[model samples]
Target: MSEQWVETTLGEVADWSAGGTPKATNRSFYDGGDVPWAIISDIQNGPLRETAKCITPAGLDAIGGAKKVVPEGAVLVSMYGSVGRSAIARTPMATNQAIARGVVGTQVSPEYLFLWINAHEGQLDQMARGATQRNINKQIITAFPIVLPPAPVQERIVEIIGAVDDHIAALDAEVGALQGVYRAATSLLWGTAEGDEAAPQLLGNVMHLDVVRTPMEAGTTYRLAGVLNAGKGLVDKDEFDGADTEYAAMNILRENQVVMRKLTAWEGPITVVPAGFDGFVASNEFPTFTLADDIAPGWMKHVCRTPRLWAEMQSRVVGTVQRRKRLNPDQLLLVALPVPSRREQEQAAEALDAIEGQVAVIRAEATRLRKARAGLLSGLLDRTIDIESAELEV
Candidate 1:
């Protein structure tokens, strides 16, 4: 520790208080309200400008009046569910009881406290005790240990970390813009008639189910793949021993084949198996399909990501119960989509694929920068590196 630094508890430098939730059954507390009511999900890494839900002045009264509300710039921390998740209120807001609000004193900057809590989130999560819903309390938050540098030094640290954060935010915005461009291109090529010279064809004519069942052998461990909802693509699930399974056989996945979770096909839990996922196993619930020779695998992969196709599949969903509705292979084959010329399909896929490649690269860089930020913050706080003399470029 630096000789000049003072080790102190959070309560010593800030006035902390827990928030409250208004009665849910009462309409007057929430209906047509303007007050920003924050929950655990609203705590982004930076300032929270708005929230998912709102409350009225009556709602404020129901929660115990003005004391429950925290002013703008107040640092808020989650005590339940996502322990240590913190955010600075960009505007005056009231939080639920699961969050603790802190009004910092002159000894510490709000940003400094926010950063400190964020940096120690994992530690806080460990302090939290519970099997199902891990949580902490206002007392734990108030007594949480913090290392405080002098006021100027604290501001310098914030500045150094804030710059990296700004760069990340800018990169994220760039990714968003690129995504918009991708969506615009997708809509132009797939949704419009001008881009597709050929007439639309029923899905059955272009793709057919090819369920390849590989018999499960006892003592053999199998790596499983599951399709993520919202077309996020395939994810590697847990490995399971064949001896533990009741099924005699499992469907094996192949690269370029499309897979869909029959139960949630309406919600877009569909994707094309990528290269690394080939030979992975899935249950029959996730049916695989092979595309016709004329269809470009890349083009079909892009199609699997489209919401319009999902909506069309959704209409075919049938069942007595809403959640139980399933889109079977026979029904999925009936869905129609425009069949662009093979050349056009290849060109469109190449253009969109390039944009996707750029997005992936940007995301990877952003992740690396975040890790660097964490390291820099740790070094500065622990006095391993001096913020004043170090070059701040991230």
Candidate 2:
């Protein structure tokens, strides 16, 4: 520890309190409410600016009235689900019992405390106790160890971290704007209504199920992949030895081939096998298809991600149990897909791909910035890195 730093318990620097939930059964407590009723999910990266739900003044009264209204600038910590997630309240807000609010003393900066708490989320979560939903109580929270430097140092630390945060926020905004553009472009390219230039054709006409199976050989290892629900794309599920396998064979995935999880096809567990996942294996539950020569790989991949296609599959699903429902290969082929000329399809794909490529680059940078922030926070708090030496541009 730095010679100028002081070690103390969190309670010594902040007055701690927990909030309560208003009576849910009482309509007077919530109906037509304006008071922001914060939950664990609302305690995100920065300030508790707004919440998903709200409560009436009667609801405030139910939760101890004026005392329950956490003041703006207070640091809020989630105690239940997503335990230890921390944020500063940008506005006065009421919270459920699962959140702990801390009003910092003159000696401490709320922003500093919020940053420290967020960085130590894993430690606090470890202190939580529960089998199903882990949680920390007032005793554990109040006793959490804190390293406090002088007020000015705290402000400096917060300032350095805040710059990185701002950069990340900007990058996120860029991704969002680019995504909106991509959505508009794809909507035009893949319109539901038939246009004079677009000749709609049955999926069966342009694609066929390719039931290529790879027999598992003993002593060989296989990399397995699974399609993410809602068309997120293929993800590495696991790696297993062929000797331990229960099945005699697994479906082989080829690059640019379309694959879908038969069970959740209605919910869009479909994607084109990207470059890196080529030669990966999946179970029979995931069916594969080969597109015709005229079909653009990028176009088919976008179609897999479209919600309209998913909605169409939903009505075609079969099975008595909702969870067990499946969209069979034959049924999937029966749907009519809007098809344009090869040139138009390729042009649309290229445009959308360009926007997505930009988004991916920005996102990668944001991730790097986040990791750098974590390291900087650790170094600053431990006094290993001098405050004056810090130069976080973003």
Candidate 3:
């Protein structure tokens, strides 16, 4: 550690204050308000521009004199539910009692402080108090230990971390755009005009449920696959114990096969099994399907993801309660689908595949960048990596 570096509490480097909520019974306090009022939900990994709810000046006054408006650049932390979540206020705002505002003083850079708090989230989580819903108080937050460096060094550190974050944000934006394109293409591919001649047929004619259970043997290891809700995709269920004595019957998932979580079919937990996950096992809750030779598995997966199909699946759900609702395979097979010619299906698949491939690459790059940033944060914050040397590279 350099001689110039010092260890200090957050209180020593910034002004500390807590926020409060106005009385809910009074309609005048919140109706047609101008002040942006923040809640714990408003605290994210980045700067907060606006909030879910707003408050009038009378509402602010009702919270009491101490809970004043927090200005832009002030670092705010959630002290109650979702403890340790932090963000910078991009605009003037006031928060509920669950948030603690740290007004950056001349001693420290606001960005540096925000990044440091984010990097040390585990410590904040450890400091939370209570039995039911864990929480931290103003005292705990203000007394939190911080490793301080010179203002110039802090600015350089922020520059290094901020660059990677900006890159990640850009990649995320591109991925979103690509996904929108894919959705639009799918809509075009499935659109039916008044005189369109695409044949409408039952799903059972094009796809069949692959329910052949490959029962687990006594001592053999098997990979488990889980379907993610909301059309996310398949994920390896590493948490499943294949060696458990009470293992149930599981169906084997093959490449290019479509899988759906029966319980969450309404919410769109359907996806095509990509290559390299060929032999994974899935429980009955996740039913697998094999498409006919004429149908493209990718296109079928997208069809299942559509809100129209999801509504049909919801109608087929059979259960007494909402959570218990499950889609019956027989009923699922009876759902209608518009069948296009083989040539058109292949062309649509190719277009969607191109967009999806680009999205996958960008997402993988984002993951790598996040890991690299985490490593840099740890090394720089702990003084394991020389700030001056890192600054030169940046």
Candidate 4:
């Protein structure tokens, strides 16, 4: 650890800058270029490999003063729409104004700073000021207060946490590969593959759906109404504890049941009600179902989510201004399913399940690595541990 504990701003660590979008007026700059242009969309896919758009050399001159490309190792954090999402740059590239470019100092290892920012993710959200479009300008990020530790301790914490990151990344690749397999299998049977017939059938024929109409205790129903950020697979009763019970009068959900939001501000059509919540009552807004024994619930759910089904569902949208799209029970029952042999269905289900399990495990590992990385950053930056000689990863 440095003999003296020092405090500083993020700007002191390195050059903190903002970016600007190149002019859309010029059409020639956007096509066929080696330089990858990254926008807010880049991070949505998880660690980006290549950008969706690229710019030519002329594009750089157009936005001359607006921040330039950061080195491959520098960290970029999304500061608009959603705040505090951080990722390491994999290659030299330009980012849009939605991100704050953080160039770390020699006193701090770049990777260590990334972990620290991640630890302060909640703070990043808290520090943001705008309501309509959340944002943290370069000034806010650069001037943000930060605790510093000796170089050696930063290195050690980084090492320990970085090893976990590598392990998690490996698992992520395997999970992705498995998921690709499942996608291929579905595409083959569903005509989603290239050169296949473009037949989009109704959603009802593939599986069975039953909306729960039962009432819950005390005029209140369960919270597993098949909605939430994580979707309705798992239930957290605490969320339902203080909610109004009058709306809780709905039917109970069962295992292997496919549930969906009949009306929601956000767009989503399907979710699975976990088996544990088998007898739980849902709100009137949710439609619950049971998958036939012959069919794989996983495949059936996939079918319900196909582009074909979504288009058909869109045509069912009614109600002016509010624009509510109701699922026709009869129409849903008539949707055609890709009838594979019972054995193929089981095998496909098992393979898809196995792949999904692997994806879940890798995702869990990624979450843990992120947490460990955060923990180490907090400990090291706060000087919770005295450093004479320490090992950390970057």
Candidate 5:
């Protein structure tokens, strides 16, 4: 530790309090309200600018003295559910009982405190107390130990961290904009309008389900993969290592084949398998399909991800409740699909492929930036790297 730094409890450097929730049965408390009411879900490891729910002045009064509206710049930590998640309030807002607000004094910066709490998230989780659902209280938060650097040093640390985060945010926004353009272009090319001349074709005519199974070889290692909802693409399913018994009868996924989670077809968990993911294994829950000569692989994947197709697939679900609902291969093959000429489908696929390639590049860059930021944060907070050096690097 640096000789200039002092060790102190969070309570000595900040004022701490918790929040509350109003009665949900009261409609007047929420109807047409403009106030931003933050919940545990609203804390996104960054500044809180908006929330999923809002409440009126009456709602604020309903919580009584137990909850208080925190001003802008106050740091908030999730005390329950997702414990240790923290964010700074960008605007005046009220939080639910699960969030703890820390109003730092002149000796500490809110951003620094947020980063500190984030760095010690595992410890915070351990400190939580409960049998069913673990939770931390105001006392635990206030009494938490923290290394206190001078206010100037704290501000410098924030500046270094914020610069990298700002770059990441810009890349995220760009990815979103590119995705929007791709979605609009796909809709225009694939959507059937009233005046369209092309006849709609059954999906079975353009694609056939691939039910090929490859039993896992004993002592052989395989890369397992799964599809993500909302066209997020494939993710390695290494977390299911113990479920190798389940993979014994898993189907083999080939390059350019479209795969979908039958149970989550309504939620759009479908995508085309890239060549990099070829030879991966997926369970029966994920059904793979091969495109016909007339259809483009990329275009077909986008079609399966569209909301219109998802709604149609949902209609084919054959169970009483959501958890039990499933989309069978027979049901999927019968869905109607808009079929444009091969040339038109190719052009649309090309455009979407370009957009997706750009998104992939941005995501890769963001991952690198995050790694660098994590290294820098650890060094700076632990006093292994001096503030002057970090400032110069920034």
Candidate 6:
């Protein structure tokens, strides 16, 4: 520990509070209403903003004045399940009792504090000492302390790190726009044959063609995870057995097949089952299907990962659980897929591959900058660099 490093409780510099849920019995409380309800899981990046489910004002009040609400930019620390993850509320929101709301004191800045808690999430876990669920209470937080720098120094330090975050957010938006450009380009190249100038043949009609694609063990395996990695198309096969594994019904694998994640947990993930995962079998929740060989596996992978097809899956899903939606296999088959000639698909894949490369670089840079920002905060709050030592031009 440095001379500036001080071991103390968090209770002294912040107001620590927990949240509760509204009565589930009251149906009138929930229904596409305006008030955004934040669950502990919703605090992924920071303080909660938008939520998957909305509750009415009545719903807000039903939980016994639980509406104290987490403020936009407030520090939120998870105390259950994914313990010790900390984030600053990005927007105004509310959370359940599983997260502790920390309002920092003048000696600390929320941005700096957010990074501090995140960088030291494991340390915060120490305060949570229970057996079943490690819970961090108000007393634990207020009493938990880290060495702090003078307020001016803290502000300067936060400013330095905040600039990096601003850039990362901008890059993310740019990558999203580029994807739209890619879709438009691909559709024009492969979508429809104009006016049937030449006979457009049905895929099933031409079964004996040499160019048709396939998966390793097509329909037999249940996919649990490892399907999609955003622009990465399909996540390369890796075992995902977190909850517990080894199912009796191991779906057989095939080559040139398309695997779609049915459960919302892996929803939106699609992959062209590669040969490397020749016999890989997934969980029952994932539904697998075959794509005809006439369609290029690479091109099909591009189209399936696009927003157009993914959004269509919403109406076909059914359930109320958080990971609720189940993709309709039959509904998926009927959907018109743009098929390109083997030669044309090869060209399209080349273009998509390039764009994906660009996105990957941007994404890697973003990750690096974010981690760098975290390191800066660790040094800032730890007081290795004093306020007087940091000279700011502005």
Find the number of clashing residue pairs for candidate 1.
0
Better structure of 3 and 5 per TM-score: 3
Per residue, candidate 5 scores C-alpha lDDT tens digits across 1-394 of 3448889988888766322234445433333555555665576666764545765556555653344445435667655564333333332324322222333322367678778877776777777777556577778878888998888788888899989889989988998998898777776556434436356788889889987887766666777898898756799876334335655678878998888888867787888888888988888998888988878887776776678788888888888888878889889889987788877777667777788899899999988988898889989989888778888888
lDDT per residue, candidate 4, 1-394, as tens digits? 3265468878887555422224445433334454565655564413345544655556654544343344445566655664444333322234222212333322366666666766676777778877666677778788877666667656766676666667768877777887677667555444322435435443454456676575445534345444542232444454354245655456667777877655632344655665666776666666666766666665654555445545545555444655465655554455444555445555555655676677788788778777765665566566674333325233
RMSD of each: 4.3, 4.3, 4.6, 6.6, 5.0, 7.9
lDDT, candidate 4, equals 0.56
Residue-by-residue lDDT tens digits, candidate 3, 1-394: 4548789988888776422224345433333545566655566767764544765565555664334335435677655664444343332234222222333332468788888887887887778786556577668888888998888888888998888889989999999998888777776456434436477788899889987687767567888888887666789876445567366678888888888888856787888888968888887777878989988776776676677677878788888888878887888889886778666667666777788889999999999989988989889989898877776765
Q: Where is model 1 poorest over a 10-residue stretch in terms of lDDT?
A: 91-100
Q: Per-residue lDDT tens digits of candidate 2, residues 195-237?
A: 4447679889888999789999998999999899877799997
lDDT of the candidates, in the order given: 0.75, 0.75, 0.71, 0.56, 0.72, 0.55
Q: Where is model 5 more than 4 Å wrong at Cα?
A: 1-3, 17-35, 57-66, 82-107, 130-132, 188-198, 214-225, 238-250
TM-score against native, each model: 0.88, 0.86, 0.80, 0.65, 0.79, 0.65
- Candidate 1 achieves a global lDDT of 0.75
Model 6, span 200-230: residue lDDT tens:
4433332221222223343343343356533
Per-residue lDDT, model 5, residue 67, is 46
Clashing pairs in model 1, backbone N/Cα/C closer than 3 A: none
lDDT of 1 by residue, 1-394 (tens): 3448889988888766423333445433333546566655665656764544765555555664223345435676655564334333332334322222333322368778778877877777777777667567768777789988788888888888889889999999999999999887885446333644457899899889999999899889998999987777999998899988888899999999989999967998988899999999988898999989988889888888788788998999999898899999999999988888777788788888999999999999999999998999888888887666555353
Clashing pairs in 2: 164-394
> With candidate 2 superimposed using the best TM-score fit, by how many Å does residue 62's alpha carbon deviate from the native?
8.4
